[model samples]
Target: MHLHPQKSLYDLAQQHHLEGLTLPSLLALTKEQEGYSIDKAKRFLAFQGRINNEMLNHQVIIQNPYTAWFEQGDQNPAQIKAFIIQFSVFSNQFLIAQLHKMIHADTLESMHASKEILANEIGVRFQSGQQHENLNNQSSTEGSIDGSRFSFSAAHFEWLYIIAKKLGLSFAEIGQPKHGTHATLFFCNELIRLYGGDNYQISQAASYAVENWAAAGFWKQLIQGLQKYNDQTGLDLPLGFFIWHDKLEAQHAAHTQEELEELYFTQNLDEDAFIQNGNEMLAGVAAFWDGLEVQRQELATTH
Candidate 1:
């Protein structure tokens, strides 16, 4: 599973291009000491807390200019398409790894949560108008996975493989991800294992951020780009990933919000701890996006 990381961002970008990515105008990358570092975890959390508080006061996720650019269809089409494919590659690489590790549970509440998570990971099917009905049938308190059918890892990879082909990428190319992609995967693993047999702590932290504070605008822009790509190319590409996530994540946010609220009142969840976990998770996600941005710029320079 450990493939060699690409040495040159530009070279990696080209590889991605061969896999069906579009190069866009390069943006200046402000050089920082590269590589993921968790040493600044505390400081990053404090900074994120300030930002979160500001958002709460203002009632907005604070629009990223990139989202606006994409939504307006002003950004380079090829670059946007590359991003969509790269993100899918990234998610496919590590998402289930984290989910599998999360299956180990100690407490009843955590066990229920884990089952619910695993069921989702397996992609339980539901008929149209039956999504909520099925979810409601799932235990609200015990968090059971009794009726949920588990999906094979191969089946999931097949989904990714098909999507990549539709987007002009081969399975082999999509599997070879940049360091940033691995960084995101590594962080998820670390978050789950960081608490030393107390997986629930870090899990709550990471989950709360992803399910609550992660930017909605970005996903909205991504969906718009994917739809446009399908339209322009006249291709029946697998856009179910982004399209489903656009809706599912919103519901996820709501569910996690309720979970947090319950924990805050009943479990005496520390604000600082909660914020720290959320921000640390966000930091990893930010690194993933930063990698994509740098690759975009590198690709542009070559073109």
Candidate 2:
């Protein structure tokens, strides 16, 4: 969905009478941004919880005394997207997978190892002349969805949709902003094609990412500020689940968080209560992923 004019950072901060950097200005925005309440009533109450903490926690900095998200009240869709990409690149979960530090993030230690995966992935290099096919293959070897491949427990799929929809976005709309996740994936794929990085290869690399980005076109470039992060985090994320997660949504009843944990996380729970609990329809979500296996294999092999 397009962002509302009012949601622009500059616009929002301006609404609160904040247009410059100062303690009063910062204090005012904390009341507005973190003070934002989608479900809560009485904006004043919202301010009380997160406002002071943002400053105390150093989550909101005053360096250079700039006010972009706070004063400008606007973020070009591209800037908002760039923020996600740049920040996510540093995520431990994403990097661990790239470095092959560990298969996936299940434990806190491995998860912590991933904290700098992006920084490392970007700066760390494969030893020259030491690059082995096996190492690159290790990256490719980590299990991936066959376009038809579907292995997530149905409970997982249900969780994504419930979180996404409840947050007022379709799962389809989550990460496709400026350099959306897919765009990043395409860029990596393109760079691999230009493995030598010669002049000729440079053009091809740009060409490849540009083509994919072009195909996605308008909406990809015009992403608005985030609507809800529920789609990005706070839900079970199986790698590349975005591609097939939506397929399960049409098949399940609407769900809430409690039901999802009960079904997937709990040792035992009644299936019927899922409706009240806001879990995905387990049968359909499971079937959808499992059903995609043949197709997934075909896509993986051909692509």
What do the candidate models score in CA lDDT, each in turn? 0.49, 0.30
lDDT for each residue of candidate 2 in 178-235, tens digit (9 for 90 to 100): 3234434433433323311333223222222222222322121222113222244443
Question: Residue by residue across 43-151, what tens digits does model 1's lDDT show?
Answer: 3335445636733222223544445444654335456546655665565645454455445556776666555554554454322323343221321212234564454
- Taking all chains together, each candidate's TM-score versus the true structure is 0.63, 0.17
- What would the TM-score be for candidate 2 when compared with the true structure? 0.17
- Global lDDT for candidate 1? 0.49
Give, for candidate 1, the lowest lDDT window spanning 10 residues: 21-30
Query: Candidate 1: deviation at residue 9, Å?
Result: 56
Pairs in clash, predicted candidate 1: 22-78
